[model samples]
Target: MYIDLAATPDFKRSLFNAIVAPRPIGWISTVSASGRVNLAPFSHFNLVSTAPPVVMFACNAPDDRHEKDTIVNVRETGQFVTNLVTWDLREPMNTSSFNAPYGVDEFELAGLEKAASVKVRPPRVAASPASMECELLQIIDIDPVGPGDTFSNVVLGRVVALHMDDRFVDAGGRFDVVRTRPLTRLGGNQYASTGELVELGRPNPPR
Candidate 1:
């Protein structure tokens, strides 16, 4: 059956979401100007570059109540930490996604402790397998075609520091991806994890 986003669903669902397949979740943590910390998960996130080590996450339109706490705090402080969500921390990661009031601290809400970040004001998750401390580079707010500045906000950050769990590091000092078991979002209400490894050597350039 063919679905039309322009008319049928009334812009409720977009085929782009499911067709994109699995996406990385940026488990972001930010601190308010008043010292409150907000932790939330943004599935619309990924590392954009490796040279300067930049990461980005996109926050969609705000709810009727107010703007999301994560976006608000990041704007106020200009710093945020991206914590890796392992399979073990899935419950707390989901718990942090709850929509709470502005000053509420999601770290405590999820029963997690805050670890001090060396280069940023926001703290990292104490139990996370890895984390990236970042400084805000830019925030691009996509203008909505209609009304409101509520389309989407894209935030880019330059990684200033990194934290890794020693156990996940191999003998050669390389981080083990399969062992980390990073949690990822799938279509609908589905989720996935890195189970097996698939290695393929790139083909040589055509003559």
Candidate 2:
């Protein structure tokens, strides 16, 4: 059945998350200018460019006039880190998703250890398999829905540095993603983990 998104109600809008199954979670960590730390998860995130290594995540404002602490921190310091979420860190990652008040430290709230970042002010999750330090590029605002004043902000950032666990590196220097078993979000309240391995080669026509 074809569904008209413009006609759909706000409650039904979340169905898009189900339609786009198994999205990778961007467990982002940011630090306020005053040194307060914030950690949160966003499934509306992915790598948008590889030439210069950029990633993006969509963050919805808490209300019509104010943004979330993550966005505020990102805007304040112009830096953030994406900590890869894995099956092992699922609990802490979930805990970080809480709507903690501004200036609240989600790292401490979630009981996760923080590691110093090489090129950014924000710290990375020490137990995460990988982390990418990013500098803010821009925040694009989405148009509000009918009668709604609040909108989502798409934050684009250029990856400036990366941290990876030595255990996940291979002899050939390739990072083994399947072995890391990254976690993903599914439909409402559902989550999943990487379970199987598959290899597929792209078609190579005569060059």
Candidate 3:
């Protein structure tokens, strides 16, 4: 059956996210000017460009709370880190998703180890297989359209440094996907991991 998004689908839950399939999860960490730390995971995230190494994530305000610690810290300090969550660290990563107080340290709360980032105030997750330190490039507020009238702020950051576990790297200096086993968010309360790899080449070649 065909249903317009404006009409709203009568399913168990909104199938939009599920229909989009597995999405990369971004485990973001930030530190306030006063040294408070915060961490949260977002599935609405992806790498935008590679020339200068840029990534972005969408942060939707919960209820009427206009300011989350992550957004506030990034805005105040202009820096944050995106830590890659693997299947092994899934539990701790999930713990960081809780809505805690502004000054609450998620690392301590989640019982996870933190490693200082070389270029950012926010610490990276020591358990994560990889992490990227970035500086805020832009933050755009998306206006509500129709239906539930939902909106979110898209935060773009430029990567300045990256840390990766040696175990995930091959002798050729390539990242071994199987070793990384990055965790991804599926629809609803589901999650997935990278399965296989396939390569495709151009059908036509220039003479």
In terms of TM-score, which candidate is strongest? 2
TM per candidate comes to: 0.92, 0.93, 0.92
lDDT of 3 by residue, 58-88 (tens): 8677774776778889899999999999988
Which stretches of model 1 miss by more than 4 angstroms?
1-14, 146-150
The alpha-carbon deviation from the true structure for residue 182 of candidate 2, after best TM-score superposition, in angstroms, is 0.3
Tell me the number of clashing residue pairs for each predicted model. Answer: 0, 0, 0
For candidate 2, the 10 contiguous residues with the lowest summed lDDT are: 4-13
lDDT of each: 0.88, 0.90, 0.88
Q: Give the per-residue lDDT of model 1 (tens digit) for 91-203.
A: 99999988877788899999999999998999999999999999999999887654333567899999999999999999999999898899998887778898667889999
The order by descending TM-score is 2, 3, 1
Best model per lDDT: 2
lDDT accuracy of residue 64 in candidate 3:
49
